[model samples]
Target: MVERYAVPDHQWDMIADIVSPPQKMGRPRRDDRLMLNGIFWILCSGAQWRDLPERFGSWKTVYQRFRQWRDDGTFEQVLSRLHLRLRQDGLMDLDTWM
Candidate 1:
């Protein structure tokens, strides 16, 4: 059995909580959320996705997943949900600017 490097469960769970699971249609071994998180981490760190560390898996995989999510509106849905949740919690008040 190939030893899989265990990604932090909590972090993975949080990411999963924020985003809907990708439909399993292609390769069964591919992890769409992990790949997308790696791409997001790169963006948040202001680094190129190509510079992503090996611990996050292949950079190409992450990049491809990011592109797929972008095209499918997955990223937008996640962001919108987060924004709405924040607004509902009063953590982000648009009316403060008015």
Candidate 2:
């Protein structure tokens, strides 16, 4: 079953390219949407990484990806881009969010 906090396809499409850029070499990466859903589950549910659902794959993998993204400011970039997209679409009000 899909997780409750899984990002919908439309939303995922907005940030997919930014979140998981085309890899240049080596083995392919895990599914970003799944990992993102797992990350969202952790953040929204306030659960420990160890408690991550199995559908999201190994907790360690998700944790590691989370760390990599965190250290690289991926989250910030995603949020910025999302904000821009939403505002341009008239779906978000910057003042209200702030």
List TM-score per model, in order: 0.67, 0.88
TM-score of candidate 1 against the unseen true structure: 0.67
lDDT of 2 by residue, 1-98 (tens): 44489888788888989898999999999998788889999999999999998989999999999999999999999989988989999999878997
Off by over 4 Å in 1: 1-24, 96-98
Best by lDDT: 2
Best by TM-score: 2
Cα shift from native, residue 64, model 2 (Å): 0.7
lDDT of each residue in 21-49, candidate 1, tens digit only: 65568656466556755876787778887
lDDT of 1: 0.69
Q: Kindly report which residue stretches of model 2 are placed more than 4 angstroms away from their true locations once superposed.
A: none
